[model samples]
Target chain A: MSSFAPPVQRLITELGRLPGIGGRTAQRLAFHLLRASEEDALALAEAIKEVKARIGLCEVCFNLSDGPRCRICSDERRDAGLVCVVEEPSDIIPIERTHEFHGRYHVLGGALSPIDGIDPEDLRIAELYTRVTPPADAPQDEHPTPIREVVLATNPTTTGEATALHIAAHLREQAPQVTVTRLASGLPVGADLEYADELTLGRALSGRRALS
Target chain B: MSSFAPPVQRLITELGRLPGIGGRTAQRLAFHLLRASEEDALALAEAIKEVKARIGLCEVCFNLSDGPRCRICSDERRDAGLVCVVEEPSDIIPIERTHEFHGRYHVLGGALSPIDGIDPEDLRIAELYTRVTPPADAPQDEHPTPIREVVLATNPTTTGEATALHIAAHLREQAPQVTVTRLASGLPVGADLEYADELTLGRALSGRRALS
Candidate 1:
């Protein structure tokens, strides 16, 4: 049998699973939880549960949302025609923080990683194709809502690079009317979007170079 | 109004309350939680609540416990007479991992942080004193348990050092018969026990030096 009680062991195990926490750090966190006031401890617990219960993926953009559409997608002021495509929901934050993009976004869920068996089908590529292309039937209304441009904002990593290329090429064939562009090379050659500083990312947005 | 949806904002606000997590990290974690599988998200949530529900302070030694006494204090094999005094429950893990000590522990809650107004009374110092000194009256049916040496294994920080000094001095007056020794100087002078590597902590445990 182990020296620590079951609750202590459980706390340590759960804490160790977090991104940066190690065995020692987990133990410290476990002890901190042990010492915390009942209300405070339960507050953290309720927060986790509440987040899980209420928060969900945005149907339009695949970012976090409480309802079907995220705040960005639901906003009438947002430019729907100019959709910026990226790999993950977390990527949306750095872009949002920069205040550079007035357009809405489309999260691909993940980049195309053939080595990982994540091909074009694994992402929301089909949805992106539909979002840009003119509707199958002509609109009964006075004017059809046409998508004008799509910025391929996937990360600069190997997978992110390949995904952008695949999306751009596919969009050219599927939706020739829409202008397709890729983010510029201001991103450090091989860094993930998660790690890039805001200034570099903002510059990349402003100085975005075309893939075509 | 802020751009983020209410659920996203709520999660970010709650995450920011953690010890080291800032606004950006909180936002990232919140989004990560949103993307996480319902099972994974609920697992972390239940773990937090379950820990608080099941865990409590060890009355005997002040380490975390599910019941009246912690696993260490309740274990029959552990030498209760040879108690290891530590600044916090986290300190107990390194000592256990070393496998050098086979004794129970008395968690001091925290070291004396005068700037923060944390004194000896703020910790379980009086309780530690009581444990070291047995009651005068002996039970007729049972042989009285003998409480012997106390290992003052507080951290090596300025606050930790001061706490150790205060404990040693108090123990001298309260329980003159008991031997109170501090862990060896192999520990770097100004560091907390949490940062010390296992090998160094192990060496320090074995080479424990007696206080003057």
Candidate 2:
């Protein structure tokens, strides 16, 4: 029989289910919670419950939100005409941190992976197309600023690349007026050339610019 | 302002309070929980709440328990006369895993650290004394078997060493009939002599047993 009580064992099992958490780490976390004050322990439980109860996908872009729309989508200052498409809601954080993109975002939910059974239909691709190209019967006054540009900010992986190309091709056929662009893939900033991979080096050479 | 919604941010903050969980890890965990099914997320929250509500300190040894006494304390098969003293209840796990100890345990909560202001009074030292040496008026018939041996199994750190010596001196004066011993400190099994520290090497030589 296990040394710990049933409740402790249950807590350990639950914690072990989290991403990257091993059995030893789960035990350590359980003991920490046990040592923590009742208020502190309850606060963690309340936070988990609250996040699940309140947070939902944004109606417009499918990013995580507490209400019908995400904070970025609700903000009047952000440019709705320009949208950055990413694989997941978490990807938006890094782009926002840079302060370079003043436009809004559309979360694809996940990238396309045929081997894993994830396809364009499985993601929010259809929803994205609807946002980019509204029906002709819709009032133009309501959407005064038409979608001008779409920047594909998906990851540099094979599936991410495939998804971006697929979306770009679809947008070209459906909404020819909108410009579709992919994030530049080249050598990472401040990286040593000796350690740079062949693929990244090849891209850097092709995308090289003349410094005037 | 943070990119995440208020509830998402709150969950991240709460998860960050756990030991070894940094800001990035907390954010990852929060996002994972957000993506998880309601049943899975709520199960974790419920488990945390249940552990806190149901588990408490064992009345006898101060180990974590769901009832008045710990499992080891309640087990009639365990040796009542032989007690293994440890700094924390967590320490008992490894010893139990070894299957070398059939005796009950006494959890001291923590070792004496003068620098950290942790003294004997702060721990369960008084309770241990009571268990070892009952009052003179206590009926002999009620206690069928008197405590015969105490194994000090605290860590080999400076504070642990000091606490063990302090307890050993006290027990010697209080109960001359009881045999007080300490866990041996030497080179660990399967450890290389060349890699061993000077102090540990010296202890191994001094405490070396005669070959059979």
Candidate 3:
């Protein structure tokens, strides 16, 4: 026999399709929505609709935005000469939380994975090249500063490393003046170095700098 | 500065209110929704709206339903004379899944919790009594069978046990003819006897029935 009403079953099915949510979690969420006031449930619906309707990729950095440019790209105080490249818009959150990078960002949408059939053409690599290149139409005063450094802040995974190296090579050939750097890796803060993997330990040893 | 746009932040805030969902998970869900196709996202939204708009409590059993009577209550084949009382509508699912219960259900909405100020008046106990009692107005052919048994299937938690005891006591005083029973408690099937808790093992020893 059918368990729940059609609407409830449909809601559960839709909710279950999310990345981490499962059948039980979807049911819990659906029930929560049922228990919530109309204003609250409708607000979530409206937010979903509004995000899709209004938000789009920034023209400059391809980060999520409500207009042509994302907030960071539009801000004049941010260093225009520095750019941080990441895999997805979500990655920008942790970097921003660090308060270390004062530059803008480039969202690749995803990292290169040959086994998964993803390649440089699948991402916004051409746009990155264009952004790094000096705009021919704009007057010198309009575009005063050229990007001097591009930080490859992609994940530490194999695909991320490959994508960064590939991008760095292209940038070196096309824009030789720009400097490329990757985030430092070491035993995580509060972690016991005894449990650190061999690859990470090897990288830590080689990249070690003079103690302050 | 705001990490996300207004709509994005609002969606994250709303999603974060769900049980077990943290701020990061909420942001992840919001981003997934943003990336989902319009049809997929709108379908979820519409389902949420439809469940709230159409569904209400079952008049007879207090289970969630689209009309006055729930599906089980409306079905003529179900054993209405045998009622299984439970704490919430969701509790009915596992019982149904077992395929052992062909009887109808009565949802209590919640168990008795004196600390939380829950009492008999707060639940549908009166309605259950009304169901058990022979209706004065119904014709002989229309309402032939009076409720014969009430299975106290509330959760085995403290409040659930108290609610079941309270209901059993009231039923004995008011409708002594009706049989009252509680679900058997013991070591779960496939569980190691050595690992079974003392209380459960003790109950199993005391309530052991003769092997066929």
lDDT of 2 by residue, B1-212 (tens): 46789989989999999999999999899999999999999999999999999999998789899999998888889998999999988888888999999988899999999899998999999989888987778788644567899999999989899999999999999989999999999999999999999999998899889999
Q: How much of the real interface does each model capture, measured as fnat?
A: 0.67, 0.88, 0.51
Candidate 3 residues lying further than 4 Å off, grouped into runs, are A138-142, B138-144
The TM-score ranking, best first, is 2, 3, 1
**Per-residue lDDT of B1-212 in model 3, one digit per residue for the tens?**
36587878888998898878998899999889888888887787778778878888888888888888888988888998899999888888889989899889899989999899998999989888888875688667645568899999999889999999999999999999999999998889998998999988998898899989
TM-score of 1: 0.83
Tell me each candidate's TM-score. Answer: 0.83, 0.97, 0.96
User: Of the pair 1 and 3, which is ahead by lDDT?
Assistant: 3
For residue B42, model 3's alpha carbon misses the true position, in angstroms, by 1.9
Tens digits of lDDT, candidate 1, B77-179: 8886798999877788789988999988999988999899997789999888877774557453222356688999998778988999998998898888899
For residue B200, model 2's alpha carbon misses the true position, in angstroms, by 2.2
Please estimate how well model 2 matches the true structure, expressed as its whole-model Cα lDDT: 0.92
Candidate 2: what is its chain A TM-score?
0.96
- DockQ metric for all predictions: 0.58, 0.88, 0.67
Candidate with more favorable, higher lDDT: 2 or 3? 2
Q: After superposing candidate 2 on the true structure, give the runs of residues whose Cα lies further than 4 Å from its correct spot.
A: A139-144, B138-144
The CAPRI classification for model 2 reads as high
lDDT of 1 at B109: 89
Model 1: per-residue Cα lDDT over A49-157, one tens digit each? 8877887778867877778888898787888879999898778878888888888899999999888999888899888886777466746441235678899999987
